[model samples]
Target: MSARQRNAAFQAFSWLPHDLRNDNAAVFAVRIKDLGAGVQTCLQLIETSELEREHIRFDGPPAEGDAADVPLLSVTDTSILLRLAITIAGVISEQAEQFCQASEDRLVKARSAATSTGVDHE
Candidate 1:
């Protein structure tokens, strides 16, 4: 599906009844570190991989200005980070789908019960 449809599917809980919404608590995975560690983190991501001397491509960093001043990751290293993001987003989408489906089912059952009991379910 398109990204918009995926996003809307992820937010499908908004369409559920209030009672069904109350049954869910969203879960997220988070990483936390002490302050001022962000710069170090970025540096580590790039420096973690070293280009070999025999490499035919990339020719060892750039011949341009300020190689020492730049924080750059090779394509392979950057791909790892991008894949992590995609994996997390996929998890979130799966969670949303399960939650919304369960919620809709619960609401339907609740309404059905109410009607069978001669109660007005508006």
Candidate 2:
């Protein structure tokens, strides 16, 4: 995802609740990143949608009074959300780079095999 898309996703997930973040906080346990509960909640929502679905549904529009358990994504500071967006975007960029590298390697290997086999290389 580009930075634009990443920011949009971060903005979208700002409604994530507290428990969800705490549940998935272990993902970053090996690493040390001091993220707020609200930001962590949003990250969890993005990383673990299956568990998040059980806690918060997005299949359809929420009903009245159904938002009782929901916590604000960044109630105190939009800056938090922005910072998290940058972090999330960095992760996405790394993944995309890896994927692209794999794709290029596959392409090179395929071409090499085709040439060695004397097949009609395209």
Candidate 3:
């Protein structure tokens, strides 16, 4: 994913409820660069509804691993958390869009001033 996407994810994750956020702060505080990786590995089961219903199918007994290492949250609870994370991400994306537009406006004004001042290209 793009830096913007990861940043949005991190921002969203940070906006969760205090108790839950604190409980999972390590995962919630994941670095911007690690959002995509973390999501794929740690939260893959929480994929979009379409993907979950269409692509995910279980046919055999579950494999055993380090269950103790995993969080004990139920699917409903996990969905709520993921929803909050995505909402925050959307906010971040909107803010970035605004910032980019403002930056472009400033650049345009700066270029106009430079041209009007008889600045020459090298």
Candidate 4:
């Protein structure tokens, strides 16, 4: 999956449906911290074994002038803060929808397989 898809999957799995329904700084900060930990865990897993590290290469950090080195937002007004919150809420809502759809699809596939094999998946 692409980075965006991976991020969406992480968000979907990390936060509950109710958690993603809010978009305040405190909630966002917690989500950011959790995502950072998840990313670090994935990196550590990738580097765990010598064979995997040798075959799978990761690029170095971004250069000094890159966007990653810059902060994206600074809120000086309530209106701007409100807009930011709305945008975050929209993104999180979309991620939740995607998660729900994927879950339903998986459930359908599992049921189909169980029927074919004469097994009770429930």
Candidate 5:
């Protein structure tokens, strides 16, 4: 999937409660893969406490290389997967808003052009 799609999927999956963040959650093993390419990045959620465990990855497509073998997220560790996820979601949302703004601008320009040319828009 595209990075946008992957980001979207991650955002959707990350919204789950701490208890349901495991593989048993609605969307488990969410492999975003290659973010931009279709490379698969798998997520293996393990529960330890309200917030502590490993988000392991047995396979990470290829772009990730050996880093995929490492835990992608873990409250036990110092890495900020949860925080990163939130940041990614914010970035994705901003990008979406920008895309919508650009689209609306294009439509406005098109409408203006049509009016200037006396072309029927409807």
Candidate 6:
């Protein structure tokens, strides 16, 4: 992803609840270098909350009556989270592609070396 796109992804994190922020005290705590880790953290939080029968809570669009503690996602929040997830997935896919290409390059080089050394190339 382009730097600008990555930056926008990080900014979308602001839509998340303060409790869900990577670091509640820091503004924009989610960094480009920690994209995968940030996404992982968010996913874990969601999974854990779901398992406990709790929806991720937010401040606004107050829930009706006794549902405030486990408020469901507002339409805006759902859209924002979905978009953020897609952006994160794109970045992760790019990183995986790069890793696979690098691995292939290394294997080709190793095979070349083995052939030259007459070491029974795999």
Clash count per candidate: 0, 0, 0, 0, 4, 0
How do the candidates rank by lDDT, highest first? Answer: 6, 2, 4, 3, 1, 5
Residue range 84-111, candidate 6, lDDT tens digits: 7678978877866776686799889999
The number of the candidate with the highest lDDT is: 6
lDDT (CA) per prediction: 0.53, 0.55, 0.54, 0.54, 0.45, 0.59
lDDT of 1 by residue, 21-67 (tens): 44444221111121124434544564453333224245555566744
User: Distance (Å) between predicted and true CA of 3, model 5?
Assistant: 26
Q: lDDT by residue for model 4 over 14-111, one digit each (tens)?
A: 45355454544445556656555554554444334433333333544456776552222222333354455556556666656766686799889999
Error of 4 at 79 (Å): 1.2
Worst 10 residues of 3 by lDDT: 53-62
The regions of model 1 sitting more than 4 angstroms off are: 1-23, 26-67
TM for candidate 3 is 0.42
Task: Give candidate 5 misplaced runs (Cα > 4 Å).
Answer: 1-79
Task: Write down the TM-score of every candidate.
Answer: 0.47, 0.38, 0.42, 0.39, 0.43, 0.45
lDDT of 5 at 78: 29
As a whole number from 0 to 100, the lDDT of residue 93 in candidate 1 is 68
**lDDT at 18 for candidate 3?**
44
* Model 4, C-alpha of 18: deviation from truth (Å): 25
Model 3 lDDT, residue 96, Cα: 58
lDDT of 6 at 42: 59
| Error in Å for residue 36 of model 1 | 22
Error of 5 at 53 (Å): 5.2
Model 4 lDDT on a 0 to 1 scale? 0.54
